[model samples]
Target chain A: MKTIEEINQKIKDGNAVVVTAAEMTRIVRETGAKEAAKEVDVVTTGTFGAMCSSGAFLNFGHSDPPIKMAHTYINGVEAYSGLAAVDAYLGATQPHRDPKIGIKYGGAHLLEDLVRGKEVELVAEAYGTDCYPLQNIHTHFKLEDLNQAIMINPRNSYQNYAAATNSSEETLYTYLGTLLPKMGNVTYSSAGELSPLLNDPYFKTMGLGTRIFLCGAQGYILGEGTQHNTEVERENGVPVGSAGTLMLKGDLKKMDPEYLRGATMPEYGPTLYVGAGVPIPILNEEIAQHTGISDQDIGCRIMDYGVPRRSRPAILETNYHQLRSGSVEIDGTKIQTSPMSSYRKALQVAEELKNWIEKGEFFLTRPVELIPSHGQTVKPLQIKRPSILVKDLKTKAIITATAQDNLSDVARLMVDNNINHLPVIDKEGKLMGIVTSWDIAQAVAKEVQELTHIMTKKVIVAMEDEPVEVIARRIDKYEISGVPIVDRDNLVKGMITAEDLSRLVCSRDDKRGESL
Target chain B: MKAWLNFSPEIVNKAVISNLMKNFDVSFNIMNANITPKGGKMLIEISGEEAQEGINYLENQGVHLTPVKRVVKKDNDKCVDCGACLSLCPVEAITIDEEWKVELDDQKCIGCGFCTSSCPTKAIKLAD
Candidate 1:
């Protein structure tokens, strides 16, 4: 087995054979992993996709009179300025303060403009201080004008990510790109086999301080990225969905605008499209095997965005081979597929990295510490506040009726309580059915005297401990205005009307308004 | 020539399109259509020897025709070849080439403007 030092010596001697991940796939397929490992010195991998967790740290040199800037804005988007004066962190997804400009232009756009060497307006605000008296500073600057502009992305290069599909009636505008209605199309954001993390599945050659191609500039892996999970299920040594991620840091001044672009998806805010590549030194046969994995071997889950929840239901499991083929079958319908990530740019990144290695301008580095292969998992945010339940609703007393009761009497009871619906109950207070004002009017028109003839036999209901959100969904789904809260024995505990639920919402909103 | 034909409520369900093809010696291609039994509009390109005769016949049937040229324009400089507009294109007018560059086929585009909105950079737009 060869070491990184041996690979570095080969590069310096101009004898190192560096092949792209795509080329390495063919080499290993023909010459086996062991032979390929001996033949290839390094396997360069690349991926270009919209990485939202990317940002830049800029030190816009201190203004005249040395203003202690507490608030800073680049272009129209606000940047985090909680640090020292003149320093701010501009996140890619941060939107402009103006609602009209929200998502259309953002920090990503400003970053792109900076890389393109375009002039951007810088605005800072602060309270007048003794040491730094200037309260406000408005200026213009270019990339070269900044004292230090560093790209420190908390997450980039996901190993694999879920493919998106919309199963709803209306089109969904999401960060995954536009998902057309009724599974109209599927969109996935990954370079698949050419992706950096997929080629080095277990983070073998990649870790803290590992050198990488970050948006046309040399960068280092800071550590495990935020939400980097290694506990995901794997197939053919690659994680099925989004698993491993890398925290990357690079000099923004050295980045190329072509490799770093700003994209504003309709309705979804702006995100930075990053071109990144990692060179995997083929030190052993295992590394070669991992690099040799093809698009067909890599699998990802197809998630339905129609669910409108954090854990969207998986429609099916699909591989990049099926996805890249322009169409995939979901629920027996042939659907057109599109890649949100750019494969062409990804290939360019790979080719560029290969050239760098061959020209001996870039070298492989051993990781100071390996990224954790286990114990890391995605943990959802948990709030300690109590959720509103149907039982918790201080609903009005549940009015009841029996089959023997006269329809006019029940109608009178509804009129007296100013209620539209009344739950029909049995002798033991168990709910039998329900009747609404419309049913009473129908009974009058049909000349029906008995409540049995007018009352509905099937009643939609909610459980006592069920979350109010669930009951609200049922009310919306069934086109009803209310539901009877029932126990396990079908005993009517209370009634939750649309009015009651709306009041609850207003109260919660009032509390929020107070805090605001 | 490319022309948009508007069918009124009275003539919407009539066999005007079929009759035009059967009676005329001209060749026509239906580029786009949004029709119901009540009324609708259709974009079609008509050509061949009796094209003028077919236009006269359509006019006689109270069909309003508006000559259409290019419907959509794509600014190549602003496009990133991201393929966001590929799947949303109903007519398959937009495609990713072997190099993954986005290619727009004007001949196939019905000017639906589906790709215009999906483009993040606003690179593609419908002609006014």
Candidate 2:
């Protein structure tokens, strides 16, 4: 078997045989792991997903009178100024403190903007100290001007995660995405077979200080992530759920902003989309075999986020193969699924890492400390949704069509609103009819019929205080897509549809055992 | 030709679309509209022999027109099938297929530029 040193030598000599986790799987399957292990020098793995515990430490060169900045805020996000002068750590999920700023543009944006070489406003406050006398300072610093900007993320590289679905009657706005009402859809966030941690589930050669591909540059594992747990169950070498994690650190100057970005989820706060890559040296047949695991072999539970809990009951157990297929069966019902992690980016990371290794621009390092097998009674975080009557859900400005309006115009209104339901009202704004997507489709197909002919005259409308569940049931039972919310006078005030119901669910859908 | 129609509050009650259909040989499809008492915007596509005349008539009839030369485009290579860009779509232009993979309908999109920012991978872009 080839050792890491041998592999490095091969890499240095441009004779190394490196393959992605995807390719490694195929090789091992063609020839047993034992046979493939002797031929393969490195198995590269990668993951690009939201990593909240991620942050970067920046050392802005000391200003005129070096302020031992007791407090620091970059773009209104509190940075860890507790360290030495001008040195601070900005956490990924740190909220934006500026009054006009949004959660979408916070600490992660600060990191990204720094990497992009944009000017960032820096604010600091320091109580007059003996050595440092400056009390307050405000200035702009760019990445090129900074002495050292390093990314020191404490936790990342979740081995596996759960599939997230919404089961509640109301729509949920969550990190998993908009979970449609009544088990409408499922969304999972995992790099799957291409994921670094999933490929080397047991962290064999991936330990402390293991050289890795971070963002666009080479990085290393600093230590076991803060929540690193090895007590979890494993099938072969892969963790069933979330298990081991890596404490990663990298140079911000060397990272790529394309692989590292900041995002703002509608209801959720700011988060960093991290692109991480790990290389597993083919030290032995076991390590090679571990990298050979395919998506079909990786197991993840489809957990319902409808229940507001850390660990919700699983709807079904599924593999990445089924997940990658884009749909999975739950209770015999087909549900659409989407990944939160960008497989395209993950694959790019793996390919980039492979190229670097081949070009001898990067090398692998043996782990100083490997993670233990994991354990956790972890649960997928449920996004809390207060089930209220239709009245509580504020409807946007009601856009209606006239009874005499042409069928094409009715369809046009629906298209503009990106809604299927269109309330046909009188000149005084009294609801006379409602047009559903089916009605619009019929209108489009037939090339005939006015709004009066296509609209459902016997409208299924809801009262303001009507429970959302009732509307949902009616929409389902009647097979109608939506119901217009009306007043006691029967004047249309707002409308709700199947699409509206789908936007009501909520959850974190974060990595680690909670969601795979 | 495609143009965004801005109708003022006073013109909201007019049957301009019907008038255009009856007067011109052009056939039109509404991509999106948000007509209200306060005024509204409409993204529409018109095609036929009288397309230019129809656009001129709409403009002369108090309907301001801004020809849309480009729309939002999505890159298949950069897309990860993540649903992050799904909820931000106003026109339901972005939809999840049976497999939960996100599929974008370029025609339905109003090019509002919301999905571009929401996209974590920066796969969606506005292009001519």
**Which number leads on DockQ?**
1
Candidate 2 residues lying further than 4 Å off, grouped into runs, are A169-171, A180-184, A233-237, A329-335, A374-516, B18-29, B46-61, B65-69, B73-83, B86-105, B108-117, B120-128
TM-score of predicted chain B versus true chain B for each candidate:
0.75, 0.65
DockQ of each: 0.58, 0.18
lDDT of 1 by residue, B43-106 (tens): 8999999999999999999898888777788887777677888889888888888888989887
Which parts of model 1 are misplaced by more than 4 Å? A386-501, A506-516, B4-42, B47-49, B56-69
Classified by CAPRI criteria, candidate 2 counts as incorrect
Best-matching candidate per lDDT: 1
Q: How well is candidate 2 docked (DockQ)?
A: 0.18
TM-score of 2: 0.72
C-alpha TM-score for every candidate: 0.81, 0.72
Judged by whole-model lDDT over C-alpha atoms, candidate 1 comes out at 0.90
